[model samples]
Target: MIDQYYNHSTVYQRRTQDFAKSRRISPASTRLYTGASMEPYDEELFREHDVKRGLRNADGSGVVAGLTRISDVHGYRKEDGKFIPDEGKLTICGYDIADLIDNAHAEDRFGYEELAYLLLTGALPRYDELESIGARIGGLRLLEDEYISEFPITTKSKSIMNVLQRAVLLLYAFDETPDDTSAPHEIDVALSLLARLPRIAAIAHITHEAETSGVRVVVPAPNASSSMAEAILEVLRGGPDFTHEEAMLLDVMLMLHAEHGGGNNSTFACRVLSSSATDAYSAYAAAIGSLKGPRHGGANSQVTRMHADIREHVEHWDDDDEVAAYLAKILRREAFDGSGLIYGMGHAIYTLSDPRAQICKRYARSLAQTKGKGEEFALIERIERLAPEVMRDVRGTTKPICANIDLYTGFIYNILGVPETLYTPLFAVARMAGWAAHRMEELYGAHRIIRPAYNSVMDDVTYVPIADRH
Candidate 1:
C-alpha cells in the first residue's frame, strides 16, 4: 500500500536497507541526509539530532527524519551561504539573484528551480488524491486502444519513439482545457495521461513489432486502467499467459524508474509547461523531445549498440592489453562521442555510481540466468571490469567511469525478449508517473510561471538597413 507521507521514516529505512544490501554495505553505511550537506551514514544519530533540534516530521512530529525535506524545516545553510531548510520551497533557478549571485557553484544552467520544484513536490503525492486521479485518468484507456488499432502497418520508416511522439500529439487533441480556476480540473487530465501513457507506449511497441515482423500481436483492453505495470503487461503478454513473476518484475521496474530527482526530459517538460501555465499536453510534448536526445533516453539504445560492437570484436579482446589498445583507439578517434556513443557507461549525475544501475545489474543477472544465456552475463562482467580500465588509461583519469542503469536495463529488456528499439519508449512509460505528480503539484500551489534568467553570451549589435547593404 502507498503510504500517506511518501518520504516517511518507514520509506527511507526500507530504501536505505534495500540499497545497502544491494551495495553490500552495512545499514549504518547508508547515510541519510536531512539537507544538502553530506553526513555520516547513521540513521539513529540523524534521528536523534532531529529530535533534539525540534525538527518536525511531515506528520508534524517533534522528530524529523527521512531524506526528503526534513533539513529544510530545521534551517541549515551550506558553506556557500545558500539556505537549506526542512520546510517551504527551495528555488534553484538560474534567474534567482541569490542562486546566481551567491550560489555560483550551482551547476544547473536552465530551469534548475523547476527541476527542484518537481522533485521536491512529486516525491510525495497524497494517497487519496492519487487514487482519485488514477481512477479518473484510467477512463482515458480507450484512446490508447484506438491509436494502436489505427497505427500504420509499416513502421520501418519511422522509429518507435517517433510513433510514441505522434501518439501523444494525437491523444492530446482529446484532452479538455480547464477553466480560469482550472487547476483542479486539470489534475484529472494530468492523472489520466500518467496512467495511460504506459499503455499507449506499450501498445505502440506491440504494434510496431507486429508491423515489422508481420506477426499478429494482440493485447487485452485495459479493464480498470489501474497500474502502469498492469497495462504494459497486458499489452506485452497479450493475455493471461504471463507468469506472476514476470508481472512482478515489470511492476518493480515501472515503480523504480518512475522518478528520480528530476533533471530529466519528462520532468523538464513538466517544468516548462508550469512556467507557461500551459496544459499538460504541451508540456509533455516538450518532454518527449528532450527524451529523444542521445544523452538522455537514448542511453539504452547506445548500450545495445555497444554490446553488439564488442561482441563483433570479442574474439580479439583476449587480454587487458588488447582491450586497452582497442579502447584507446576508440577514444582517440572520439568514436563513441561522435560516431555514436557507447551506451550505458557514465552519467551526468551520480559520479560515484548510479543506484538504478545497481538495481538493473541485479535484475539483468537474474534475467540472463533465466534465459540460459550465460554469455550475456559474462559479457556484462567483462565490460564492467575492462571498460573502466580502458576509460581510465585512454582518458588519463583516475576515477572509474562505470556503466549506469540504462546499460543493464537494456540488457535485461533484451534478454526478456523486448525489441531493442523500444527501450526509450519503455523509459517514457516509467517516467510518466513522476510527470503527472509534478503537474499535480504545480496546479495545487500558488502557481508561478517558471521563468529563469540567462546570461547574455551574444554580442550587442545593431542591424544596418538593407538599403545600405554592400
Candidate 2:
C-alpha cells in the first residue's frame, strides 16, 4: 500500500516517504528553487475579512451573500416564500430543466450525456456533438485497466459511500496519465469520469445485491442506447420493460441536482484539492470522501430514516392534527430519543421551500398517483404542508423551515427501487458534473493554493517536559 501511494497516489503521508534518500535528486529541494520562492502574504487579511467562519461574512454568522455561480444557467432568486429561477437562465446550455421535465412526462427523455457536455464544455451541443459525447461516455464505462472486481466486495452493514469512495480511487488507478493537470487533459479526464461514475456506483449496488440475495449479478457496462435510468432499472429491477418516462424522470433528477455552485461542501472539496494542482482523479476522490459525511450527501437517506421514526410513534397519518403533533413532539425532543431535530424540514442555504424540492414533490405526486402510492405521498404531503408551522410554533426556530431537496427525492427514489444506502452514491453520480467543472475552473481561472489559516485559540502556551509534568 505504501509503495502504491509512493508510486501512484498523491497522498500527503506518502509524498514525504524516503525523504532522506530522495533529497539528492529532488528538483524541489534545490537552492535555486528555494531562493526563488515568493514572499509570504499576510494571513490577517483573511481574518480581518472574516473569511474562515466557514466562508461566512462574520464569525459563524451572516445573511446570504457572495455565493459564486459557475453556470448562470440555473439562476434562482428567492422572493416572498418562493424560488423564482426565471424561465430563461433556467435554460442550461439552451435546454430548459422545465422542458426536460415536460419531455419526461410526455415522450423519450434526454439522458445526462447531453447535460454533461453543457456543464463541462459550457455550451449547448449540436446533434453531432451530443452523439460523439454519448459514444465516448459509453465506451469509457468499464474499469478494465484497474478493475475493482478484484477488491473485497462485501456489503453486509457496510456503507455504500465508503464503497464509492474506494471506487473513485480505482478510477484514479485506471488513468494511465494520472498527473496530467493541464486544462485540456483534465477536462477529458473529468468527462471520461462523468460517463464512468454512474456505472461504478451501479456496480457497488450490484455487488451488494449479490451478497444479500445469494444470486450472481452480472453488472453490465454502460450502453449508449439506454438512458441512465433504464440502466439502473435493469440492474435493480431486471426486465426488458425499462420505460422511457421513468428513465427520463431520473434524468430530470440528475440534471436538477447536477450543479448548485461551488460553495457546497463536496464541490468545495473539489475546488480545494484541484487548487493544489492535484490530478482530477484525486480531486474527485477527495470530493467523494467529503460527500460521505452525514451532513452533506446523506440527507435523502435521513429523510427515509425520519419517516421510519415517525411511523414508530404516529400510526395514523390521515389526521392532519395528529401528524402535526408528531412533528412538534419530535422537534421538542419528546420522541425519537428527544432529538431536537426534524431531519428533512430545513436547509442551510435556501430560505424559501427549496425549488428542487418543489420540483421533486410535484414529480413524487405523479409517481405516487401512477404507482398507487397515494397514501405514501399523502403522509409526506402533510409534513410538507405543516412542518414549517410546527418549527416556528414549537421550537422557536427563527431560521426558515422548509422542505430541502432531500425531503421529496427519497419517495421518488423509493418508487424507482433504490434503497436508502444507495441514495448518497446516486448524489455523487449527479454532482460529478458540477464537481468536474468547479475543479477545472479552479485550475484554469483562479489558480491559487486554497490554504486557509485558522485563528489560534491558545495564543500563549507553556510546554511541560515529561519529567517535570508531575
Query: What CA RMSD would you report for each candidate?
Result: 19.0, 11.6
TM-score of each: 0.66, 0.80
TM-score of 1: 0.66
Candidate 2 residue lDDT tens string, 1-470: 32444344334333344442466536445433333132222445456655545665441223332223355333335578554433223444445665645654564547576677777887767889988887777666656733655443532337777877776676666568889988778878876777667776777777777888999878655466665556556655544456667777788788778876667789888888888998888888889889887677876787788887777778898888899999888887787745567777776555554667778888899899999999878998888888988988986666656677788888888887777778888888888888988888788887588876665433575998989964
Worst 10 residues of 2 by lDDT: 32-41
Clashing pairs in 1: 71-85, 71-86, 72-85, 72-86, 72-87, 73-85, 73-86, 73-87, 137-192, 275-450
- Residue 330 C-alpha lDDT in model 2: 85
Q: Model 1, range 1-470, lDDT digits (tens) per residue? A: 12333435566556656766788875455564222132123344445444332233432223311122111211132356433322211222112222321232233112122222233343323445445445554576655435545553322335667766666666565545533326555555655666566666676677767777999877677766344555666677775566655655655455446565344456656665755777666666667767877778877787787777666765654455565555566666654444424467665433455656666677678877878877767777677667767777666655436667777777777655567767787777666655655555555552567654433334677898989854
> Which candidate's TM-score is highest?
2
lDDT of each: 0.56, 0.70
Q: For this target, which candidate reaches the highest lDDT against the unseen true structure?
A: 2
Model 1 spans with C-alpha error above 4 angstroms: 1-140, 144-157, 178-183, 213-219, 225-227, 316-319, 334-340, 398-400, 443-446, 457-470
